[model samples]
Target chain A: MNKKGIIFIVFLILLVLHQDFWNWDNANLVFGFMPVGLFYHACYSLIAALFWGIVMKVAWPTELEEWAEADDSREGG
Target chain B: MSTVIVIAIYLGLLLALALFSKTLFRGTSKDYFVASHSIGPFMLLMSVFGTTMTAFALVGSTGKAFERGIGTYGLMASSSGLIHAACFLLIGIKIWAIGKRYGYVTQIQYFRARFETKAFGYLLFPILVLLVIPYLLIGIIGAGKTIAGVTGAKITPKGTIPGVFPEWTDNGAIPPWFTGLVISAVVLTYIFAGGSRAAAWANTFQTLVFMVMGILAFYLISDRLGGLGAAIEQAKESHKVRTLSSGGEVGTSQLTFLSYMFIPLSVGMFPHLFQHWLTAKSAKSFKLTVVAHPICIAIVWVPCVLIGVWATGIFPSGIPSGAILAKTVGVLVKDPIIVGLVTAGILAAIMSSLDSQFLCLGTMFTNDIVLHNSKKEYTDKQILSMARGFIIAIVIVTYIAALLLYERSVFDLAIWCFSGFAALTPLILAALYWKRATKVGAYSCVIAVFISWITFFTMSGFGGEYFVFGGIVPAAIMWFIGAGAMIIGSLMSRPPSEKTLAKFF
Candidate 1:
């Protein structure tokens, strides 16, 4: 798949994970104390950070670079 | 040190930072408004992150989780983690580019130029300000309440009101009116000194202070509660614990949980965030913000949500939800210094956003209203002075509003403000990506949002959980109506000029 396609799929998964349709009220504790649902989101946030990093790398717009350069040159001139 | 003294020292330090930044300011309107677009990557990340996590994330989230359960995390944190970062990646970058390309200092300036109409700017400025004032008020109110709750006299003889305060306040806490004025004045000083540059600097410092202090508060509070394990055990036994059998799925139904996801999308339309994004030195400066904002959100929000949830176990009944965070701290920690630092941390989180919101509104008024209409060529000095003047007026207005609405909870007021802005997200998204978006379409979109927002606000009594047509949030209706208006109204009117199309495309 293309990078854009991969980004879309990852974001879709993130969205699906965000919905609390499963055993969110599960009283089962993770790591001795943390609730399972709460733990799931803690991990989800980490994965989101990683996912956005990938988006920045793959989908970072080149026009922004050009704009920045143009701006720098204008200031310099 | 006493709690009052500690808080005073912290505010003094912040004022010192603000005054220090003023000396660094170059005398220009550009320097005042956007820091001459010279803010670095680290500062951008801090300022953006700080501005986003307000009293809502700290004091309000803790209060909310005390009332609800762990599901509060699922409602805001999980969705906010992804949605806020996604907005930075998609919306922030494009808008930064447009702002840079067109010399735009505010969202109104960008929207006016995008749709090629002055009337759109006139219409938009007020709607954005109306939504943002409530947001500003929430911060002021939250700070006042946090301070009052922490400092409420523990051993009041005969339950008499404190001698300094009016008879109305039976609790010996410092009046909300006093805290509001002090906070408003301190914030106004820095923003007045250096405008956006000072705001960015102060937010960066304040964000760091709050994050470190927040984590410390969490550990200290947990230790005082006799370790994390004991706290959890107590939580399990608490009557506030969520169970599927009792229909208490953490104080929210399945539909309400799902609909709560839409609230974080409000970041996409935040005028303060727009101003922050434009302050970036380069497009690359946003990379840090986009990549790390979710991590920062998780870091700050996790401790707050957990502390609030744990409070349920500690005080199973009778604590007012808004006062739970400070109340928990007051009960758990005995040392005055620790209590003082914790209160400072809460205030830091609250004030960090206030400065940015005040500066953004001032920048908007100066650029879109004052300069846009002025036939006389104003000097940069004049423009800078005008921005500062507008900020002073706004600070006073917000201070008064915070006093009038002191009885409201931070969580509810903040949700109302976020919902109003979130309903207008469709308009912004269309402006950035949709070629056919016309001036008429933007106006119609604004009208649609106003009508839906007012209808829902009246029905919900300004701020409450009111769902429509099978538990869907009122915001979803406003969102769809606004989007539909933009599409249909654009088609009804003439399409945007090819000249405008050529610039964006």
Candidate 2:
């Protein structure tokens, strides 16, 4: 699959994992302090942040920036 | 007194910064409205993140966690991290490119051009203003709540009236409305003088202040409560202030939580956010905002939710959720200087968003309605005066509205505001991606969003935790109503002009 396709799938996976029904009743603690549910979501926030960073690096639309820059240069000269 | 002194100093510094920004103001409407499109990546990141993290994220989140328990973090913060970034990646960058290309300053400008209808903008502008008014209310109300929590008199004054403030507020606090006025004045002073440029500069400074203070408050309170592990254990053991069930199920309202996923869609339509996007130096500037937003949310929210949860153990007798974070710091970290700084930090979180919202309202009024209607070039002085005058007018209106909503929960009030805009996302989404989206279709969506949102708001007595029939969130129904109306309205009516389609696509 192309990078765009992969990005889509990963985003979908992240969305699904965001609804953590499995952890709902677990009532466990993580790292001795945080509630298991809160801990899970904290990690989820980080992972989502990381995923978007990769998406920015890999899948960002350079066409938009290129078009804008090209227009600026054309106007300048 | 020391606490008051500290807050006063912070406000003074902000005023000075706004004056400094005014020194750099180029004498042009474009420069005033979009800062001549010169904001770079780091400032963009700080400004956007700062604007998004209002009192709703800090005091509001902690207060909510105190009432709702641990699941609050997962419900809003985790979901917002991914979804907000998704919005920046998908919608924000697109809008920025268009704004950069076309010199559009308001969303209505883009809509007017995209749909080939001035009438559509006419229908859309008031709805955007209406939705944003409540958003302004959230920050104003939140600032009041935080300050009142810190400064409400310890003992009630004599004969203050039963069931009316002072009597009912003896548990400790001042009025949120009073603080809202003072803070709004400070915000108005800066934005009035400096426009969008000053708002950006202040947001960068204020965002830094609030995030640092949030971490500091977290450490001091947790250390006071015998550290994080002990605090969590004590909260679990107490069970009085906690909303957790015996099984510790995060929440049984699975459907309500699911409905909240739609709330972050509001970001896609926030006029303030649109105005900020227009300030980006490049489409590439969005890369920082997209990547760093979720991490920023985690840094602010996880600590807040945990601190709120710890409050369950600390204030077992019960405390108002609005003041949970403030009260916790007051009791745990007792130095007035520290207290005042923390209060300022919370206000930083609240005020950062207000400046942009205020500026956007002014921008939309001047760019979309005033200038567009007049159809003549206005001088720089005229434009600046118009923007500033309209901003002050709206601030007065929002201040009054915030007073009436003094009793509402900041989180729930914000959700109601967000839900309206969230429902309107289909309008922008279809405008950007759907070639078949006609002006009629956009109108259908906006009108449907306004009507359904009003029905629900009125039913809930103007805004609180409300559900549609069958125990589902109102946003779920409103969102589908909008989508369905838009598709049907478009299919039945004429398509947009091919020229327009070619332009947008």
Candidate 3:
């Protein structure tokens, strides 16, 4: 699988682990103003950004295609 | 003397900057609407951040911290900043790149193009308008209240004697309507004169002033609490520090924690932020702006949190947050002159957000909805005129709403609007990323959002005993189910033409 797939799996594992560690009464363990929680939240954002970057790169159509279409429409008409 | 002069000079400078930027407008729709796409990275970064960091941060967050302790900081303020920064880095860059390629001038325009439907755009526009109007009103009311609170303005009551409206007096108790009108007038003047470009230029000046004042206020307040260590000690002593899941029983459910993530996504889809992306000069600049946005977040959130924590120690029984805010300002400095300066900084925070929001909402209405349907060709001048007219109408409507709803908490109202956007974001994101996302799916998602949000809000209105769910829970479930439906619907139904798909595939 791709780097994004690997990253997604890692994040999924971490999220599940973190959720289990925190639970309802213990939820503060992973969600507080403490250093550990802060670090976790930061990492979560970084992973999210990375995943989004990959999705945009792989899934969306190219800018060149859009330009070419605009050109074609102008000429075909 | 220095404080009064400094504030006066700052106000003068901002107004002058607004007027100077006004010259850039040649009455063209593009020029007034999106600043002719000439915004640089520095200007764009400052404008977007300035517009987002309003009185909500300057006063509301700090006040919340004072009342609820450090949990407000961790759960609401800091999380929002971090998530907002993450959004810019992730989704912001992609939107900027796509917008540039497609000549997309508005968020709804981009949505309509990607989803291939004017109907979707039309449906989305009114929702966007509704979500934004409350935020705009908060800024307006905050500004007016701050001005009245600082200046000791007095006003006549709503149903007072004939021809006798409220006026500023030595005694306190300034009427909310009086303050609202003053703020709306000033904002409308600059907005009418310069449009988005003026708002952008004014935002830069206002942001700098706000940052300096915010940092200074934090330092002074922290010192008053006997430095950082003492402040933290006092906060701990007062039971202000908590794990993230800690809040009033109503605020701390597991679902709420999970649902908080939706806010950052909503920030990504907000129309004003989308307009900021469209105004970028290049993709690289957009990336740089996104990466740097969190730095501003750090500046605002850290100090605000400290002040909030300190307030709890100072008032053990929990001074009502808003009253504590007023008293804290009163105690922080005795001089009226310095109070005036600080007050202006607060007003700047409100205006910075208000002006940009008004400009964006106005542009969306005039350009995307009104002109989208109008057959008669409108000149750029006419479009600009309509945009200005829309700004006035929005300000008036929001101001009236603020007056009617004086008892409601600004922070709660702001969060409610945020929840609306959060509900709307998943479908928008799916349209961008998922090729199979269909118009039917998009419409269904919107329908689900309307249903879920109405149900959640109606239940909340009857009080907590009636409903087991909070706003975010139902909203998130609806989004998830709607997204699934959209994908399945698209698969079962007709897809866009190959020619259209090929343009973005």
lDDT of each: 0.81, 0.82, 0.64
TM-score, first chain, each model: 0.73, 0.81, 0.40
What is the C-alpha lDDT profile of model 1 across B6-98, one tens digit per residue? 999999998998889999899888888888888999999999999998876777778777777777777788788898988888898888877
Q: B-chain TM-score, every candidate?
A: 0.94, 0.91, 0.88
**lDDT tens digits, residues B407-451, model 3?**
666545576676677777767677667787777777777877777
- Maximum-TM-score candidate: 1
The TM-score measured for candidate 1 stands at: 0.94
Better of 2 and 3 by lDDT: 2
| CAPRI-style docking class of model 1 based on DockQ | acceptable
How many residue pairs clash per model? 0, 3, 6
Q: Comparing only chain A of model 2 with the true chain A, what is the TM-score?
A: 0.81
DockQ of each: 0.47, 0.46, 0.14
Candidate 1 residue lDDT tens string, A33-74 = 677777888788898889888887878898765754344322
- Give the fraction of reference interface contacts each candidate recovers: 0.54, 0.57, 0.02
Evaluate model 2: give its lDDT: 0.82
**In candidate 3 chain B, where is summed lDDT lowest over 10 consecutive residues?**
B159-168
Error of 1 at B300 (Å): 1.3
